[model samples]
Target: MLERNALTFNPGRDQDAQPVGSFTDVRELQQELQGHGIQFLAEADEGTTGPASFIVVDPDGNPVIVDQHV
Candidate 1:
């Protein structure tokens, strides 16, 4: 479902470092969604950081992107 699209997570491992705000493209948005989700709970357990923490889905149901900015 959500995995098939481009999913991006900012600050990657540095969630705490990410500034509190919502943004669309380079500009800022009105609301802030300060939360997180899991793609593969198993990998998350092993501590996968960088782009791996994020998950994007391909047309077929496979993860196309582990991380992306924007």
Candidate 2:
């Protein structure tokens, strides 16, 4: 069995890796989650724009990554 697992979300791309017409920014997502009291293992700088990423652990101890590549 795999001991570690991670889920990644790409804000500006679809499952096929095509750019989307519109999507929420990664920073916004991070802020919203933080507001909800979710803690992050790693976080992107909210001051910056464009490509960024942040990591948070799920209830099951799996890492969830929100990565933006716009």
Candidate 3:
């Protein structure tokens, strides 16, 4: 069996999966991380809006997923 874990962020949702009134867009977060020299394995399209996602690798080799479902 193949096994792995990832850290995920849902920008528009809370811990209970309820929508919040406002939250930072995923693209903006990506840009900020990029400015800090973070690289992405898969990237969200900055040109689009609404739900999107991106992936990056942690120093420990774990996948980090930043997904937005708004």
Number of the candidate with higher TM-score, 1 or 3:
3
Model 1 misplacement above 4 A: 1-4, 12-70
Better of 1 and 3 by lDDT: 3
- Pairs of residues clashing in candidate 1: 3-57, 4-57
Tens digit of lDDT per residue, candidate 3, span 2-70?
Answer: 567899889999999999999999999999999999989999999999999999998877899999998
lDDT of 1 by residue, 6-50 (tens): 444553234665544543321111012112332331222123222
Minimal lDDT window, size 10, model 2: 1-10
The Cα error of candidate 2 at residue 50, in Å, is 0.6
Cα lDDT, model 3, residue 25: 98
Give the best candidate by lDDT: 2
2 or 3, greater by lDDT: 2
For each candidate, the alpha-carbon lDDT, in order, equals: 0.33, 0.94, 0.93
Best by TM-score: 2
The local distance difference test score of model 1 is 0.33
